[model samples]
Target: MTVATDTPLVDTHFHLYTRDMPITSWAWHHPPEDASAEQFLALMDQHGVGYGVVAAASLYGQYNDYVIRCCRKYPRLRGTAFVRPDTDMYTLERMKADGIVGIRLFFRRVPDPPDLNSPEYKLLLRRVRDLDWHVHTLVSSPALPEVIRAVEEAGVKLVIDHFGKPDERLGVDCPGFKALLAAVERGRTWVKLSAGFRMPSREAARSYAQALLRVSGGERLMWGSDWPFAAFESGVTYGQTIADLHDWVPDAATRRLITADTPMRLYFGA
Candidate 1:
């Protein structure tokens, strides 16, 4: 698996956790996994990834020292936080200064969005918007349309995880998946073509990813590892997952756009 010199892979999602934070009861499927900052950098070197966004996994709650430590260790990498609604704007500004790009809802583990439209959460989102940060969601595919509409209307860019978590049970044409396709056309919404194993099947993931590329126009799409490749563990390595993306979005240019160009433009202003 050789990556083209110009290919420029950017892993949009990965995790690091510290034990001092109370374990989230919601992350039951994947047993706790640990990877030091150096180990993660070495993994990227081995796989030819130029950059990786260390998204805060739910298990770490709001204690973000491990991820902050990672960014300090590797200035090339950026991070996102799992924040509480009451967190003040200054703290969020501090995180942005520390290479934090956005806040993640981690919606898969916590499906409900805590009413971002409510007075309190709305204020939180508004503060986040003022900083030019994005809101990343791990919502299921079926619920994406509503979530996307709400987030976009709130005036923030959205990053949807796992190809909208398309229900292989219902197939790609499912209303929710179609809704995601339509949403991507709006430009404010972006989707990560990561976690093939979590999809019902590789074939389904391929179909879903190709469909996304067609409508997303490459600019609104990004790639991720979802590394440690949690829950669906079948001895797959991060490299293999990176390699598998060729099957999902075949056009070499679109591949570059999704894996490198789009993420660079959105996350790093490259």
Candidate 2:
């Protein structure tokens, strides 16, 4: 099912990068081809989505030039970037002016990224806070709680990626999952309802969505397709992703809050 709202929908997460773009040596997976901005926008058009946030792919590391260019060229889109802890404030201000709204921190299966409490990170995160940008993170399990605490304590808004990337067997009881819920109940945390296709079980989507709705009551939640589907590209389709969301939430009005109101306000300043 496609998004049903006539109110222009907001895709809160997705990536746009060409195969020729520079990638980090440690990138877990590399795209075989481009997920160009034009292609992504066309999919949004087909599904009635009007605004989108390009999540900087961990594979591309800090090669944010392409994404920054796309955001500048297309006013309807905004982006997040991956940056070194020592990246300067002037560059960040320029990125923000170019429609880059936040930073993407990927800790999912990453053996070690960086210590947020380090002197370098402390300075970077402070700049993030002062600029009013959220830390869009992909972290799971044991690392999730620590990442959550560090980012929150630093006073930066946090947006959890992929249903908190919870372990299938633990369901909601996972310590990280528990911490995520607690974060929502207590702090400036938002969760994206996306990538259920990557969840261990299809039903996990409905269950996780219920858990978030109970606490957020729909305000701190947003929806995304995780478009191009990343490594799962071959198996999952864009329409199927939206249909999965329809099944998980079912209520059109609440879906509007996720697909329309919350994301539109957060990413687009609408």
Candidate 3:
């Protein structure tokens, strides 16, 4: 778990939801788990992650206070939120003050939260754009195209979580995944090369990460540990996740671009 000083990197897809947050009440069926800020920071220190993006989890519903507090504690960290349609510009501006860089729509195993093209959703995106906040989508592979089109047309930068949740059974070149790459190439889109197990490679999941890197220009991709790797308790490890990056991306410079430069540009604008 010793992270060499020279290669210190940012974890772009970490989550934070405390046990007190009524996590079980939310529609997302995952049981409540304790993931405190202090524990998270310690883990980052152990693993050599210099910073992290504490994205809002669906289990928290509209509550973002915990994630906001983490950002306040560490200047190097930032966050994303789960917001509703009627969220006003004033509210978004306040969240901006609180160190939130974007608003997320988490759609994992559940139904899509809201139609991206709906009036409420459109207005939310427009306001998010006005505040210059990016839109984070934690959706399945099948919903990527529609969400991508909606966010892009709204002129807000979009982030795709879990490498499109691609169907590993179909291989990387599957038509739906191809569309995801096309969207990234078109600009205005960013993909997180996280969640290797969710991808369809029964043998070695690393190939799934490689497929995303092949299509997503290094500048448009970000790396994350997806820490506390829920449901992957037995096999996942921080070292293994970082090592997988090697297979998916072969060059040192490209790895730096995806892990460091891209995240800095998007989250910190450095």
Candidate 4:
């Protein structure tokens, strides 16, 4: 399952968190060790990853100072930040100028997910669209329909985190996954083949990955290491995550599309 390609690989999703950073809220247990940008970049170099996108962690809530700083410090890195719905356009502009390409909506463990149909939320989406930014979403299967409709209506490019997080028991046939496939077909949406460990089982992960490839093709798909592995860190390693991509997508050409070509277009605008 080795892929030989000249195009540099880009990890489309990862996070950078330091203990010193303020934690306004957390989804689960706080990471035992700091996953600094320096450590993340070193992992990328060690694994030959050329560039990466630093997804804003939910633990840090609306505090994006660390992620913004990393994007400014590292020329090869881009970032997404967590911003409140009432976040000023001028402040968003400042974040954009600092190398933030998107904003994250964390719906998984948060007590209250924003109401997409609300005026403020819709206005935020409009601003994001105007700024030429995408929305990175993390939600469970049941929440996908509302998320998809809102994002589509807003006409914003969307990136779904963690394979659309379909229910493990239902696999690709899950209603939410079906909606995701349709969204991919409509264009302006991309899915990350990442955090496979988050899926219920390896078999379910493989099924969902293959279904995405069959329905949406490699052009709309991307790969990510989910570096530092979050809650699964003790069991999942960077090398293992990269290898999982090889197992899920065995074709070298398609692998190139996911690992380098598509990500370059999506994150680096190459």
Pick by lDDT: which candidate is best? 4
TM-score, model 4 to reference? 0.96
In the range 1-270, model 2's lDDT, one tens digit per residue, is 555344338888899999988887888888877999999989889878889999999888779999999999999999999888888999999999999999988876455677887999989999999999999998767688899889988999999888898877898889989999999998599999999988888878889999998988887888889988888889898788778888777778888898888887778878
State the lDDT of candidate 4 residue by residue for 1-270, as single tens digits.
344233338998899999888886545768889999999889889878899999899888888998899999898999999888999999999998888999999887788888999999999999999999999998789889889999999999999989999987788888999999999999988999999988888888898899999987787999888888888879988887887888788888898888888878877789
Q: What is the per-residue lDDT of model 1 for residues 1-270, given as tens digits with 9 covering 90 to 100? A: 554334447989887664455666665554455655677788888767888898778765677877876786678889898788889988888888888999888656564446666787788788889999999878777777777877888899888888888776787888888988887887788998888877777788888887887787677988888877666546677766776787776678988888888898888889
- Per residue, candidate 3 scores C-alpha lDDT tens digits across 95-171 of 88878999988766545468887899889989989888898877666777777788888999988887777665575
- Pairs clashing in candidate 2? none
**Candidate 1 to truth, TM:** 0.92
User: Candidate 3 — which residues are off by over 4 angstroms?
Assistant: 1-8, 24-33, 202-204
Worst 10 residues of 1 by lDDT: 1-10
- Cα lDDT for residue 131, model 2? 95
Error of 4 at 15 (Å): 0.7
Candidate 3 accuracy as lDDT: 0.77
- Scanning candidate 2 in windows of ten residues, the lowest lDDT window is 1-10
Ordered by lDDT, highest first, the candidates read 4, 2, 1, 3
RMSD of each: 2.2, 1.7, 2.5, 1.7
Candidate 3: residue 188 Cα off by (Å)? 0.8
TM-score on alpha carbons, each prediction: 0.92, 0.95, 0.91, 0.96
